[model samples]
Target: MSAVDEIVREWTAQLLDSGSVAALVAGLVALALVLHRATWLPLRGVVTIAHEGGHALVALLSGRTLNGIRLHSDTSGLTVSTGKPTGPGMVLTLFAGYPAVSLLGLGGAWLVTVDLAHVMLWGCVALLAAVLLAVRNVYGVLSVLVTGGAVFAVSWFATPAWQALCGALLCWFLLFGGVRPIAELRRKRSHGRAASSDADQLARLTGVPAGLWLACWFLIALVCLVFGARWLLLMPQL
Candidate 1:
């Protein structure tokens, strides 16, 4: 077979490969740690990367010039853009964070379905590199470097099986972990704090209630979580 044909064949094999129960178990363990507040300390930055990346993507799509994206040590991120402050673009940019991580995980699952786990890892490397160019602060730079480096390491040194396992676990974590922040946002809103959250910001910009935005996000995240579980795990069984 030609090179392209060979790649397609390999991809087909991976897509059809019924992953072992051990692999599923591994992902479950990782999911637990990724979801746990205390154990998620180190991996929190990855979630922030997805959050800020979502904002950056919508900003670009909405005809804004992305000024930069910052990832903080505290797992908070900011994406700055220059554009019309009031419009669909701004609303989408604001709405991107909560859904971004789950969407990203869904995208990753799609890649695995197409037998492109290595592509997923390499894609992370490339994206982090781009984010690095826009990073202005020490923490942001460090965060991008660490994440990019680890992914690059796996892509370069790990076996295919290891890469596949890591990819699945990462996808599961993002799908499951995406809801935690939304719950926290709801709690903060209920407590009369977090007056400056994205949902509240959207409410100010669009005249909708912040709770409604939160509710919408909650529903979307829950859906993504359920569908992602089936797509990444259960579907392969059938």
Candidate 2:
């Protein structure tokens, strides 16, 4: 068979066999990385990227002028936009960050469930590329470039098995890792810390308690995790 035909055959086989040993091992490794603080430090930037991208996306969509995004070393990001100081646009822009990561994770896992792992990886690359355009800080630029480059490398050069492995790992990371920030938000709220957090901002904007916002964010993350686990793990076993 021709090279193109052989590659297509290989991809088809990989798609049909999501229960492969490689996928299982990759998932375990991903879980370990997400659970360990040392590994989480570097990878946390991925969540931040999604969070800030969400803010930027909503800002532009809501008739706001996009300022820029800043990704800090502490795994925190800031997105600055100019718009009506109060209204649906402001509230939506503020509301976008936490759920963005969870939704991205859930979407990625769903793609893998449907055997579209490669599509998810390249889609991430596309997302990072789009986010990079709004990054105004050195760290933000580097974070997007490095993450996008790694994903691009895998999508472009890796074997189908390895690509699938990378895709699964990323899906798991996005699925599980997205929940951490919500936990952190809860901790902050309990300890009366970070009064300027997103939850706090939401509180001030809507006159709702920050704790309620935290609970809402936690619920969204938990729901995403449950559904993602079902799709990624339980469905495959059945």
Candidate 3:
């Protein structure tokens, strides 16, 4: 067999083999991060990337022109686009932010169950690379680069066991981290702040109440978490 064929055969084996990594341990570690503010605060940057990426995705898919994206130090992000202010497309673009993390978490969990933990990490690196392109601020650029580098390092340098562990931790983080921001948003909205939140913007665009939209976001996250945990833990044949 040629060298190329040997490489393909090896890679194919890696993709099919489920490395030994306990999902529960990873989930517990991620839960701790969510509970501890100091750790969770800095890590929120990853969530911001997913949030803004969701907006950017819907904008482009909706045929709107994306202006740029900005990731702030405070774990907030902005995605600007040009299009009709009031329509399903604009509403969807605005609405995608809060649910994005959970959606990603769910997807990652599915990949792991199918013995594709390695593929999941590489997918994250690719995603961050794309997000980096639309970043307009220096901070945003640095944020994406640092994040992508970390994932790339783990995916490339780590042993398969360690990579599987990290992948589980990542999915768990997304699953748990998905709910915290909505809680914060609820607090801000209760205090009459965050008038510009996605829920609020959605309210302005549509006739639905912001509170109702917030409820929907919460439900989506919760549902994703429940099902994602099942798949990650059970490792069911798919």
Candidate 4:
């Protein structure tokens, strides 16, 4: 058989044999990271990647020209794109970050529920690879490389159970991690710090209160967490 055929067959088999781990365990692991400063610090860079990638994805989808992405050392990131600065596209680009993380967590939970955690692990590797091409700084390049390499190793070489655990941890992290930043933003805004945050940007674009935008992001994240937890707590049907 040709290489493509062999690869396809292998993927098909893996898909059929996909596995899942205990949702409680994964959730707890992610919870530790979310609640602890030291543990969360290292992983914050990964969440920042997701946040910036969300902006980049929406920018492209909304017909903007993505310039490059910068992931900073402090777990902050910026995605620059050129387009109309005050239209629906811009609003969408500004609004995509928080929702994107929660939605990804939801997606990961759904994958676990459907016994496709392995698939999502590979999917993350592919995603990180794509993000790597657009990373504009040395730190961003290294971050994506390390993150993608770890996911690739897990997807390609780990046992199905380990893959499921890691996959669940990733998704669970997204779910929990998605919320902390919003709360931080709200606090900063109240203190007049994050005057240029995403919520503030949305307010500027749409003339709504930044607090309102924060509420919306917070609500969406909570809803996603609820749904994800529901999927994870219940035993996988498959």
Candidates in order have lDDT scores of 0.81, 0.83, 0.88, 0.85
Please give the lDDT score at residue 93 for candidate 1. 93
Which sequence of candidate numbers ranks them by lDDT, best first? 3, 4, 2, 1
Q: Report backbone clashes per prediction.
A: 0, 0, 0, 0
By summed lDDT, the worst window of 10 consecutive residues in model 2 runs over 229-238
The C-alpha local distance difference test score for the whole of candidate 2 amounts to 0.83
RMSD of candidate 4 to true structure, Å: 8.0
Tens digit of lDDT per residue, candidate 3, span 117-177?
7899999999999899999999999999999999999999987666766787899999899
Candidate 1 accuracy as TM-score: 0.87
Model 4 scores worst on lDDT over the 10 consecutive residues at 12-21
Query: Top lDDT: which candidate number?
Result: 3
Clashes of 1: 0
lDDT by residue (tens digit), candidate 4, 1-238: 9999999888656543433335676788899999899988889888898899899999999999999999998888999999998999999999998888898889988887777989889888888888998999999999999999888989999877667767777888999999998888888888988878998889988999988889999999999999988877663522
Total backbone collisions, model 2 = 0
TM-score-based ranking: 3, 4, 2, 1
TM-score of structure candidate 4: 0.89
